[model samples]
Target: MLRLFSFGSGARLTMRTSEDAPLVICGHGMVAQRLIERLVALGHPFNGIVVFNAEPFSAYNRIQLSAVLANEIPEADLALKPQSWFARHKVSVFNHEPVTRIDTDRGTVTTAHGRVQAYSKLVLATGSRPSSLGISGEDLDGVLTFRTLADTRALINAASTHKRAVVIGGGFLGLEAAEGLRARGMAVTLLHRSDHLLNRQLDTTAGDMLKGLLAQRGLNILTGQSPAALLGKSRVAAVQLNDDTVMSTDLVVIATGITPNIDLARIAGLQCNKGICVDSRMRTSHPAVYALGECCQFGTHTFGLVEPGFQQAQVLAQHLCQTSEATEFSPGSIATRLKISGIPIFSCGRVQAGPATEDIQWQDRPEHRYGRLLVEQGQLVGAVLMGDTASGPWYADLIDSGRDISGYRDTIAFGQPYCEAAA
Candidate 1:
C-alpha cells in the first residue's frame, strides 16, 4: 500500500493498485455534494477524497435552472458552493474532466485526458442524461435539451434573438421550459402527447385546469399531439406535428425525459436496470462499490426526485462511516410542488385511484381553485391542489403519516385550518 497525505488531522492515507484503494467519487452533482458534506461533518474517514465532475462548475442548485432561464434569478445565484469550500475540505475535484473508463479489476478510474486514479472504495453519482426525441431534424443547430446549466445558458442565449419557441413534452421540465421561454418574450407553443398536462402527476381534472391556466398566460397549448419532425435548413424554423400540421418556430427545447447514466457501471459489470442497482444500504454488486442519487435503483423503483436522493445520500454516508445509527434506505411517498409561469400546483401520494380507493374532489370555479383527496381504508392516501397551495405541505404530511381522516373527511378537502377548527 502507498501512503497518501491525510485530509483530517494530518493522518496518513494509504492505497494500493491491487486492493484497498483510496476513496474516490465520480459525478459531482448535488447528491454527491451532500455525501461529501456529511463525511466532512463526520471528520472524514479517508486520507483525502478525489472527485470527478463533468460540469465546469462545482455543485450548484440545479432545481433553479428554469428560474434562471426565466430571469427570475441571476445565474450566479445558482452556485451552492465555490471551489474554496472543496479545497478547505481537502477534496480534489477535476472540473470538466469526466471519467471515461472504470477499471474495476485494477481498482482505478481513467479520465478523458488519460489520468488514472486508484480508489479503495468508489461511489457512483453520475446522475442522468436527457433523452432525445429520436426524430429527423433533431440535429438542427437550434434544437436542445434543458438538463444542465450549459443547456439553460444555451436556451437563454437563443431566447434573446429567437422570436418563436416550441417545447415538446408536458412534464414538469417541459412546462417549466415553455414558461421560461415565454417570459423571455418568445411566442411559446407547448405540445404534449397526453390528453392533458402533467398526466402522470395530476388527474384529468387538475391537468385540464393547469392547461387552461397556462393557456390564459398567452402560451399556445396543444394536447394529445407530438412532433413528427423538426423542420429547417440549418437551425429549427418550424415543427411538424403528427397530424401534418406545421408551426413556424426558431427554437425547440425537448424535455422528453431522462435516462440514468449507467454505462460506466454497467461496463464494469455492475448490476444495472433502469439505473445502477443498489441494496438498501446503497451497496452495489461489489462490496467496495456503492451508488446513490438518480444513478441508483432500489428494488424495482428508480428515483428522479431529489428528496429520495437526499435520503439515499444520508443512508450511504452513515453506512460508510460505520456509525451505530446507520439504517437501510426505504422508498417513501414524494410530493410534487411546482410553479409554472407564476401559477402554483401541488400533488402528492396516489394521484390515481384503485379499486379499493375512493376520491373526494372539490372545485371553486369562480375562485379558480381545485382540490382532490384520495382515501383508501379511511386514510388520506393522495392529494392534488391548484391555484391555492397554502395547504400543500399539510396535505403532504397527512399522506406521509397515513393518518385517518374519517372524522374530518367532509371538510378535509377544505385544508388544514378548517379541519383543525372542526375537530
Candidate 2:
C-alpha cells in the first residue's frame, strides 16, 4: 500500500469512506475528458464514473480559449461536452470541489469539505498551471497568467478597463494573448527572451518572418528581451526590462510555460520525475491508479501538446477496459499548425537543419509565402511553412513516413502537388 497524504495542510487521515468504490478521476480538463469519452466508447467496466472538477465548468476546449479571448468565438462555444451528456452518461460530477487528499492504503480520496469517497480505480489528470518567472511584483493585482478559462475571463475583464498590455514570452500562448488583447483594442507589447519567435518550433528565418508579420499587424514585438521586474504599488502598472527600459502597461500576462500538477502523486508516494512516472499503458506505480495527460511523463519526454495526451488516453482506456485493441502509447511526430496574429504557419519534424541535412528553400516574397524542407539521408526530416499552409498535411505525412524525396528534390519545396505532377 502506498502512503497517505493531505495536500497543503500537513494533516493525517484515519477515517475510511463507506461509499462504494467506482472509477474516480481528479481534474476535468481536456485530457481527462478525452479519457472518459474513450472509456465510455470502449464500454467502461467500472460500476460508476465520478469526476472532480476544480473549475466551475466541466470539460471545454482550452485551446480555443485564445479565440474566446479575442472575441472570435463566444464564451459558450468553448464547451466540449454539454451538461446533459454527463447526466445521460450517469457520470457524477463535483464542480468547484477538488480532491485535497489521497489515502492510497484506503483507496479513497477526500475533498475540501472532508467528504471521503472510495474508488475502485483512480486516474490522475490533474493537468498543469502556468509557469512562473519568479520576477518581482508577480503578486500584483493586474499581473496574471494565461492558461485557464478563468485566466481568459480575467484578462478579458481587464481589457475592458485597461488601455495597454504587456505579454511576457513569445511562445504560442504569449502570442495568442497579445493578438487577443490587440483584437480587443488594447495596445500590446510582446516581449520574448529569445532572439526569435516560436524558437522551439520555427527556425530563425521563419521566426523572424513571423515577428515581422505580427509587427505589421500592430504587435509591438521585442525579441532578445526579458522583464527584470514588474513595478507597481498595488497593481501591476509597468514592466521594467533587463536593460532598465520601463514601459507603462495596464495589465501583465505571464505566458512563460506550464508546470505539471504532480504534487498529489508525489506526496502520495507515487514514483515521479518531471511528472507522475508512468508506463506505456499510462499506469502509475500503484496498480489501482493510473496517470495520463500533462500530469504524467513518458520516458524523458514531457508532453506539451494535446495530441500526445490523447494518445495516452486511448492507450489507458484500452488497458483499463481490458479491450482486445490493447496497445501501448507510441508517440510519433506531430506537426504544428497555428494562426498567429492572423498569419498561417506550420512546422513538423525538426525545425532546424543539422550539418548532415540539406535545405530546400522556396519563397514568394510578394505573396508572403515561404517553405523550407530539410532532407537528411534522402528523406524528408523537417519542414516549415508560412503564409500558405495548404500543403501542410502533405508535408507532415511525408516527414512522418520518412519518404525518400530525392526523386523530387527539385520540386519538393513546391509541395505535394508539384512532386505528384512531376511524377
Predictions in order: lDDT:
0.88, 0.88
lDDT of 1 by residue, 193-242 (tens): 99989987889998888888888889999999999999999988899999
Pairs that clash in candidate 2: none
Candidate 2: tens digits of C-alpha lDDT, residues 1-423: 233446457666543342446799999999999998998888888877989978888989999999999999999999998889888887898989988888788788888877777788899999988899998999999998888889999999999998999999999999999999999999999999999999988889888888888888899999999999999999998999999999999999999999999998898999999999998998899988899999898888788888889889989999989998799986667888888867798989998888898988878766777889888998988889999998889988988898777798888777787888889
Tell me how candidate 2 scores on lDDT.
0.88
Give the least accurate 10-residue stretch of model 2, judged by summed lDDT.
Answer: 12-21
Native-structure RMSD, model 1: 4.4
